[model samples]
Target: MLSDTIAAISTALGEAAISVLRVSGPQALQVAAQAFKLPPKLTPRMAHLVHAMDGEGNTFDHGLLLHFQGPASYTGEDIIEFHGHGGVLVTQRLLERLLACGARAAEPGEFTQRAFLNGKMDLTQAEAVMDLIHAQSTLALRAANEQLGGAVGRVAQAMQQEIIPVLAHIEAYIDFPEEDISPETGAALLLRLDAVLGRAQKLISTSEQGRILRHGARTVISGEPNVGKSSLLNLLLGFERAIVSPMAGTTRDTIEEIIQVHGIPLRLVDTAGLRESTDDIERVGIQRTERELERADLVIEVVDASQPPSGVHRLSLPPAVASRRILVLNKPELGIHPGWSSEPAAIPLSCVTESGIEQLRDAIRAVIATAGPLAADHPIAINARHKAAFERCAARITAARAALQSAEAPEFIALEIREALQALGDVIGQVDVEQILDVIFSTFCIGK
Candidate 1:
C-alpha cells in the first residue's frame, strides 16, 4: 500500500471562478482534516462547504471540500478535493497548508501514474489523458477519447490472446517429442500465425494516420518566386499569415502555421520561393526551404497560372520530393494558363478569389485517406512510441510466420512467438516498465 499522501493544484493556476486542489493516498483525509474544519461526519463523494485553515488555526479561505474513500477514487486511494476561489495566491497557500499537514506535492503526471499503479487505468488510458489534454483538432480529440475508452488496449489484448495458444501448442510439441505432430496440426498452427500477422499488420497500418492526427502533418508549399505562394498560405490560414506581394522574393524566410482542413490538422509551411538569388538572406532562406522540403509529409507545388509552364524548371526538386508533390495552379481567377491545365495532375486554384480551395482541401484529405478512412470506430496507435511498438510487434509476427513456413523447429518458432508476445505487451505496457515510463510521463502537465 502507498504510505504517504500526494497533493497538487489540479486546475490551471490563475484567477478564475474556482480552483481545485487534489490530494490522494492513505493520509489524504487526515491531511485534509488538519487544514479544513468540517462536520463530524464527511460523506464519500459528497461536497461540504468549509473554512480552509493553516497550522495556526487561522482561516485562509472558504471552499467546498469533497471526500472520496479508498479503492473507488481516481487514484484508487483516499482522495480529497478543495474547490476554492481561483486565485494563484489562494491555491498556492492551500497547497502549502496541505504540504505542511504531511501531504507531499504530486509530481508531473503523478496522479495519473498513481491511477495506473492502482489498477484504475492501463498505460494506454493513462496516455490518452495526456493526449486529450493536448488534442488540437476534433479528430484528434475523438481518437484520444476512443483510446481512453480502451480501443488500443482491446486490440493489444486480442493480439496477445491469439499468440498464447500458438506458444502452448509449440511447448506441448517440445515436451512430447515421442508424440509425432501431424501435418494437419502444423498447417493449423501456420494458419493461426497468419491470422495474427494480418491483424498486427492492420494495426500497424493505422500508425501513420494516428501520427498525423496526433502531430499535424507537415506540409511545405513550394515553387518559383511570386506564384501566389503567400496568397495560398493566407487563404488557407484564413488570415494574413504571410506577406503578400507582387514583387519577387518578398518572403525571405519560411512562415509556418497550423490549420485544420477537413478535420485533419496540417502544419503548413510557406517556404521561400525557389530561385537563383544573389541576395545573402534570400539564399539562406532558400536553403532553409530546401531543408524543410526534405522533411515535409506533403509538398504543395504552387505554379503561376498566368505565367507559362517553363518556370517549373526553376524548382529543380529532388525526385523523392517530386513523388509526393501536388501541383497547384494558383491565380486561376486571372485565367488558367494553357499548357499547365492540360497536365491532368495539376489542381487549378485561385487564392485571390478563394475558388477551388475546397478542392485543394479535398486533395489533402485524400492524401491522408491513403492510410484508410478515418472512422470513429478505428483503433489507431497515435504516437511514435506506440507506432514503433506496433511495427516491432508486426515484424516479430512476420518472422514467426516465416520460420513456420521454412519448417523450422518448434523451439525456434516458439521463441519468435514469445518475442512477438513481448512486443505486444510493450504496446499496452504489460511488460517493460523502466524503459518507457519516464519518457511517457514527462510529457504530462504538472497538475495532471
Candidate 2:
C-alpha cells in the first residue's frame, strides 16, 4: 500500500571505492530509469549497464542498475540499487536527480522502517539490525544474531500463548456464571501465572550481562599514588596509550580506550592516582577518580607489590569499592610481601615486563562469561527497551498473582493479565505506534 518512492545513499559518506544508492517503493525502477540513460527494450528486475546522468542529461558516472519487484525485495516492495563510483558531489547529484523525478529523500532508517511496516521484519528483528551493525565485539554480534533469528520474540510469543488460554478460561466463566469455573479454575490460572513469571524473571536477570555485551563493560583502574595504575592500563591494552612515568600523579585525568579481551569489548579507563592531595589540580583529579569508581562495573585495585598493605592509606574508598575490586599486585619484580595475600587474591605482576598479562586477561574473560549464552529454548532480553517493558510486565504479573491468591473476581484477574500481555507486546514491537516508530527509526543512519 506504499505510494511514494524513497532513496538514500546506503554507504557511509566518505572516500571509498564505490557507494550504493538505494531506492524503494512502487516507482523505484522508474526513478532509476530516469537517472540511468540505458538502451531501450531493457525489462524490470534486470541489471542494466549504462551512464547515470543528472536531470540535464549530463553524464555523471557509469555503473550498474539493478531492479527488484514488489513483495520480493528488501523492503517487501519494488526496489532499485545503483552501484557507482564514490564521490560526494556525484552521489548528491544523483540523489537530487531522483528527488526531482518524483522520488523523496529517505529519512534516517526509513528503509528499514518500511521493511518493518511492510511485514518484512518484526520490531525485534529491526532493532537487531542496528545492534548487528554497531556490534563492538564478537559476543555482541552473536547475541544480536540470536535475537535477529527470533529468540527474544519467540519467548514473548510463548508467554502470550500461555496467558491467552487462561484469559479465555476467565472470559468463559464471566460469560457463563452458572458454569462450574470455580475457585479451582482460579487456582489453575495462578499456577500458570507462576510459570510465566519464572520465565520472565530469568530473562530479566540476564539484563546486566546482556547490557554488558550490547554496550561494552565500563572497567576502571584505581589505586593510591605510585601504585602502577597507569602501567597496568597500558599492559591490559597491550599498548602504552597512557603515560607511564616515575613521578607520582602523572595521569592527571581519565584516559579511555576500547579493547577486546577474549572477543568481549572492555572500555578500559585509567584515572589519576586515588590519593589525598593538597595541590588544586591533583585534588580535582582525585575527585574525578572517585566518581569513575562509583560508576565502574569492575575495579582493578592496583597495589604496589613491593610494599605491604598498611592499615592506614591516603585514598580510603567506600566499602562497596572493596567488594567489587579485583586486586592487581603490580611490580612483582620488586618482590611481594607475605601480607599482600590478605588483599583479596591479588594477581602479582610486573607491568613494565608484561608479566601475568595472560592470567589477567583470563580472569576478565571468566567474569563476562558468567552469562555467556542462554539455553537454546530460553530467550534473551538484550535490548534496553525490551528490558524495561519486561520489568513493567513482571510487576503486573505480580499483582495478578496477589489478586488470584485473594480470590478476586475473574474480571479483575483477566484485566491484570491483559495489562501484562500488552507490555510484552510492546517489547516485541507489536504495540509500537507511528510516533514510537519514528523515534526508533530516526536514531538509525539513513542507509541503515
Candidate 3:
C-alpha cells in the first residue's frame, strides 16, 4: 500500500460550473475531513454538501464532497473528490488546503500508475486510459476502449498460460534425462509451440494497423502546381485549411493537419507543388516536400485531369515511393476530359463539386485495410513497445519450435521457452517495470 496521500485537480483549470479535485491514499478520509467541513457522519460512496476550509479554519468554498473507502475505489485506496466552483484560484486553494492536511501533490499519471501498481489494471489497460483520453478518431477510441477492457491483456495472458505448460514439460525432461521422453510426446510439444507461434505471428502482423489507428497514418499530398492539391486538402479537412489560389506555387510550405477519413485518422500533410521553380522560397518548399515524401506512409499524387497526357511526366515521384502512391486526377469539375481515367489505380475527383471524394476516402481506407480490416471487437497492440514485445516473443517461440524439430537438448529448448515467457511478460508489464513504467506514465496528464 502507498503510504503517502496524493491530491490533484482532476478537471481542467478554468472557470466552469464545477471543478473536481481528487485525493487518494491510506489517509484520504482523515486528510479530507481536515479540509472539508463535512456532516457529523460521512458515508462511504456518498456525496455530501460541505464547506472547504483552510488551516486557519476559514471557509474557502462550498462543494460536494464524495468519499470512497479503501480497497473498493479507483486506486483500490481511500479516495476523496471535491467538486467545487470552477474558478482557477478557488480550485488551487482547495488543493492547497488538501496539501496542508498532509496530502502531497500527485504527479502526472500517478493516480493511474498507482492503480496499475495495485493490480487494479495491467500495463496495457493502463495505457488505454490515456489512449481513450487522447483518441483523435472514432476508430482510435474504439481500439482504446477495447484495450482498456483487457483485450491485449487477455491475449497475452493466454499466451503465457500456453507457454507455462511447455516450459514445465521441458523442465521435467531436463530434470529426468534418464527417463528418455517418447518421440510422440516431443512431437506433441512441438505442435503446441507451433500453435502459439502462429497466434503470436498473427498478432504481430496487426501492429502496423494498430499504430496507424492510434497515431494517424502519415499521408503526404503531392503533385504539380495548380493541380487542386490545396483544394483537395480543404475538401478533406471540410474547411479551408490550406491557401488555395488559381496561381501556381501558392503553398510555399508544408501545411499539416490531422483529419479523419472513413473513421481512420490521417496526419495529412499538404506539401508544395512538385515543380522546378525560379523562386528561392518555392525551391525550399519543393525540397521539404521531397523530404516529406521519403517519410510518407501514403502519398496522394494529385494529377491535373484538365492537362494533356504529356503533363503526366511532371509527376516525377521517386521509385521508392511507388508502392505507396495513390494517383488522383483532380479538377473533374473543370469540364475537361479525364484522359488519364484509364490509368491503373487513378481516382478522378472534383474538389469544387465534391465529386468522387468518397472514392478518395475509400482509397485511403483501402491502403490501411491491406494490413487487416479494423473492427471495434478486434484487439491490437497500439504501441511500438507492445509490437516489439510481440516480435521478441514470436522469435523466441519460433526458435524453440525449431530447436524441438532439430532435436536439440531439452535444456536448450527450455531456455528459449523461458526467454519467450519473459518477453510476453513484458507486454503485460509483468517484467521490466522500472524501464517502461516511467516512459508510459509520462504521457499521461497529472489528474489521470
Most TM-score-accurate candidate: 3
Q: What's each prediction's TM-score? A: 0.90, 0.89, 0.91
Clashing pairs in 3: none
**Candidate 2 positional error at 347, Å:** 0.2
The lDDT per prediction is 0.82, 0.78, 0.83
Kindly list the per-residue Cα lDDT of model 1 for residues 247-278, writing each as its tens digit.
Answer: 99999999999998877889999999898899
Model 2 lDDT tens row, 123-218: 888898998898888777788888888888888878877666666566556654565443336567778888889878878887877787777878
- From the highest TM-score down, the ranking of the candidates is 3, 1, 2
For candidate 3, lDDT tens digit of each residue in 1-448?
3789999999988899999999999888889889988899989889899999888889989989899887888898899998899999999988988999999999999999999888899999999999999888899888898899998888888888777767765664555455553233777888878888887887887787888888888999998888889998999989998988999999999999999987888999999988778999999999999899988878998888887666643555577566778888888666556567568678889887898988988998888676565745465745788889888998999888888889898788888988988988888889543433343234222135
Q: Residue 219: error of model 2 in Å?
A: 0.5
lDDT of 1 at 349: 91
Misplaced by over 4 Å in model 2 are: 38-47, 176-184, 314-321, 369-381, 431-448
Best by lDDT, which number?
3
Tell me how many clashing residue pairs each candidate has: 0, 0, 0
Q: Which has the better lDDT: candidate 1, or candidate 3?
A: 3
**Of models 2 and 3, which has the larger TM-score?**
3
- Cα deviation at 296, candidate 2, in Å, is 0.5
